[model samples]
Target: MARPLSPKLSPSIIAQAALDAVDHDGEFTIQGIAKKLKVSPSSLYNHIDSKADVIELMRGQVMGRMDLSGVDSESADWAGSLRIIALHYRNAYALNPRLLPLVTAYSVRDATTIGMYNLMAQTLRTAGFDSTRQLEIITVIDNFVLGSALDAGAPDNVWAPGEAASPELRAALDAGLGAPDRAQKSFEFGLGLLLEGLAREAEVLG
Candidate 1:
């Protein structure tokens, strides 16, 4: 009998199955993925070493959506470049917010994702940041972007303080909460504040 044109199992296929499981269940197990793929658990083991490998694959799937090639770390507009990269990174993760917790729990080993970090580091270097500051800036950006990504998936009523809300807090939430583009606007506002702070640091610390 002739073999199938496409193999039944492959890394991408397994990874996708695992990703789907995570999307639906917020977590995945070897047996869950195997059943989802209608394959034996041993078959999955053949493709991936362990659940950690699957997590990394899922991280790649999400982070791979980021396009950093057009971003020029060597440009004089290093801050602008970093801003663009942050938007790309946040948008990519916004698609799979549920995957955030799992990925954060595991050490990142995805090459594509690491490549994005490498570009961010280069951008900071161009902005006159030293090695220590570079790592610090990167961590700040990582934490902020991840939090923003989760925010993008937040419910329309992000805060429901009800009667307990102080007049000031109530007024703020009433005006902004569930507003159109609330998440995007909030993220841009926050990113601007971060960039401004970084700019100030660059002047003194560069």
Candidate 2:
């Protein structure tokens, strides 16, 4: 006979369990998570519909940790608020590098994700941009942050953790072809540039 499942665990609990498995084990598998949580695999199914649900739950958990309230849309320094928001995202990703894959793959349909997008859109509106242009500006900023983080985190010749680099790669690295602080610097620079362009466009269009 099959053992009865515990009613003590809720969906949120199950989702959190799954997150713990990924955070500690660096992998997400049904059996692995069940074993870690001391629950029957079937029990988890009672809480979550699929592995996709688990991933979405974890992604929401990560995004929920971000503090978007600090971004004051009514403040005169709207550009600075945008910069702070970008820095918050960068710092969050830097702390949890594993979440980068999820951030890249996850869509913005979830409430937590939508909240993030809406916050950015609101900031843009506060800066005197309309909805359409706000979205474009948000997209531009997101892409810049994503690309910069990925580039900074990518393994370069000198910093490669795998087998030693080839001689030519090493020579190229020796030629001073990299910026270790490129991610932070580039993020600020890109935000400033984008905001400036947007301001110019607003003036021209007015």
* Candidate number of the best lDDT: 1
Candidate 2 residue pairs in clash (backbone atoms < 3 Å): none
lDDT of each candidate versus the true structure: 0.88, 0.70
| Clash count of each predicted structure | 0, 0
**What root-mean-square deviation over C-alphas does model 2 reach?**
4.9
* TM-scores for candidates 1 onward, in order: 0.93, 0.71
lDDT by residue (tens digit), candidate 2, 1-87 = 996665476656665676776656665787877786778898788767777777777767766678887778777677787888777
Q: Candidate 1 on 112-169: residue-level lDDT in tens?
A: 8989988999889998999998998999999999999999988999998878999999
